[model samples]
Target: MVNLEGKGGMKREGQRSLLEKAIEIILFVGALSSIIIVFLIIAYMSLEAYPALNLDFLLGWFWDPKKEMFGIFQIIVSTLYVGVGAILITTAIGVPTAIFLAEFCPRNVRNVIKPSIELLVGIPTIVLGFFGLMVVIPFIRDNFGGWGTSVLAGWMILAIMSLPHVISISEDALRAVPNSYKEAALALGATRWQTVKKVLLPYAKTGILASVLLALGRVMGETMAVTMVIGNPRVAWIPTSILDRAKVLTSTILLDWSYVEIPSMHYHSLFGIGLVLFFIVALIDVTATYMVKRGVIK
Candidate 1:
């Protein structure tokens, strides 16, 4: 009977090993497939956009469909402007909120605040856009004495939209810091503020930067919300002020995509803009990964 039991246990172990191997193979294949799809998308975009790549095409400011001329310089400028502004605002609001939640807030308050922030992440972008249009736009117009649909409105909306992501990521980074570090600092007679500023902040700097980069990418790629608030304008250059109407790449694409004729240069130009946006997001991801890895090494 003991021999029979030992034989059954060996068989069970063998089956478990086989199942593990199968699961590994499946995961490996899925990862490979994902990588292949990404490469294919990049190749396709490059092929479509290559024809539209010329000095005149890039440098010209006109986007006339009749003339088949389209330059995205203004759109690119607006995207950068709004994206940077949004990132700055989100960082300002989110970093402090994250620090407070992670280090200062009571456990009950932290629980409530953390769940609320996570819930914000699940809110639909279109809904956020509509909210901005109805509430934020009117508030801005009434208080600031400008058109409701302006770059500033777009920036503020995008900042709010990105806040959850920035705060969550930053909070995670802060929470990941070993309690021992704080304890050691306290033992050394450092005040809470000093310990947070000198020890915690420096230790979490890379993660914080990574979160900011991720927020930047989100602000850059966000379409529906930004489109609703950006006050799309057919301008030859980026607007000089926050109150001025502007056109971002995503907004331009959303506005023009349906009307653009198939196989036309205008359509191709949109694809080219998409390619550029993709690269910008990709660059942010790569930079964030590098910063995280460098921090790990340090």
Candidate 2:
């Protein structure tokens, strides 16, 4: 009977080992598939975009397919303007909300509020764009002035879109700091706010920056909402201020792609624009990773 029981235990261990190995193989394959897909996309875009992928297309100020002009410098600048502004607003509001939720909120309130904030992510960008057009645009026009569909409107909408990501990730980061650090700070005669300011925040800075990076990516890549509110300038227009109407690269691609024939210069140039966006996002990710590694961000 002892021999029988030992044999059964050995069989169970063998089964568990096989199951674990299978799971590991599945996860590794999944990760590898993602890497493969990204590379494939890059290769495809590069192939299609090579004809129009020169410095003249990137740095020229005009972008009229009719005139055979496909410069994206101004569009790129406007894209940066809206993206940076949105991130600034998102970080300002989201980091504070995260701090409150992580360190100061009552448990009951936090439970109710945290999920509600995250729920905002499910709200469709089209709906947000419509809301901006109807409400935010009118408000901006009536009070702040401008065409209403301006960079400021784009900034405001994207910030709202990005807020959920920042708050959720940043709150998690702050909460992830060891509780022992909080305890130590308190024991050292630090007030709750001081402990949060000097200990919790500093310790979780890396996580907060990660959240910001994610939010920046979201802001830069967003399409419908920004397209609707950013005035979608069809010419070579650069924003002089937050109130100026301007074009962004995504909107230009989105608005123009439907009209262009496949294999046309316009179509190839659109792919070139996409490639530039890809490179921009990649550069941002690489820079942030390097900064974190070098202790520049932390």
Candidate 3:
């Protein structure tokens, strides 16, 4: 009886071991698949885009199909400007809104507002684009000028789209902070506002930074919203001001996909822009990761 019982225990242990090994294999395959897929995309883009990767080709700032010429330096710059501008606007608005929600709003108000704001994310980006087109664009044109389809319009649209992500992540970060820290600051007679400024902001900054990076990622790769309102101009520049008409790398492909043909120099150029946009995103992610690893946010 003792021997049989010991054998049963060993059998159960062996089964558990097999299950663990199976899970490990599954996880490894999942991880490897992601890496494989990413590499495949990069490899294909690189092969297709290599032909159009010349400095001269990229300087044209416009594609002339008859001339078979293309230059996207300004388009790249516009993408960067809109991306950065949107980040700035969203951070200003979203972070403060997050602070209000996490720190100031009554529990009841927070409960209602929080979910409502997040529902904005579920709202299709096309809806947001239309909001910019019919409403926001007209408002901007009325107030600021320049045909309304300016970088400012794109910035505003992107900011609206990004708010839910930024506010939610930032509020969660602020809330993740233990209540003890705030209590301690108040106990020491610091103003409620000061406690948040001194203690909460610093401690919660890592999460806030995460929010900014995520929003930047959204702004960087945005297409439809940018396409609808960015006023992708023929004679593009580095976007001297917010009111200037602009073009971004993403809009180039999506906006022109119909005319670009399947497999041509134009298509290759679009692929090159796509590859460039991919790297820009990867770089932001890598930089943020490096900062976190280096304790830059502490």
TM-score of each: 0.88, 0.86, 0.86
In the range 121-185, model 2's lDDT, one tens digit per residue, is 66799998998999999999999998899999998999999899899988988998889999999
User: Taking the tens digit of each residue's C-alpha lDDT, what string does model 3 give over 1-298?
Assistant: 1234687878887887899999999999998998899999999999999887888666666555556767877787788889988999999999999999998899999989999987776668898899899998898899988789999999899998999998998898888788999999999999978988999998888888977997798788888888899888755568788888887888878876778777888888878888888998988888767765664435
**What is the C-alpha local distance difference test score of candidate 3?**
0.84
Clashing residue pairs in candidate 1 (N, C-alpha, C atoms within 3 angstroms): none
The weakest ten consecutive residues by lDDT in model 3 span: 289-298
- lDDT scores of the candidates, listed in order: 0.86, 0.88, 0.84
What are the C-alpha RMSDs, in order, of all predicted structures? 3.5, 4.2, 3.2
For model 2, the run of ten residues with the poorest summed lDDT: 289-298
**Positional deviation of 58 in candidate 1, in angstroms?**
3.2
Best model number under lDDT: 2
Clashes of each: 0, 0, 2
Q: What is the TM-score of candidate 3?
A: 0.86
lDDT of 1 by residue, 20-45 (tens): 99999999999899889999998998
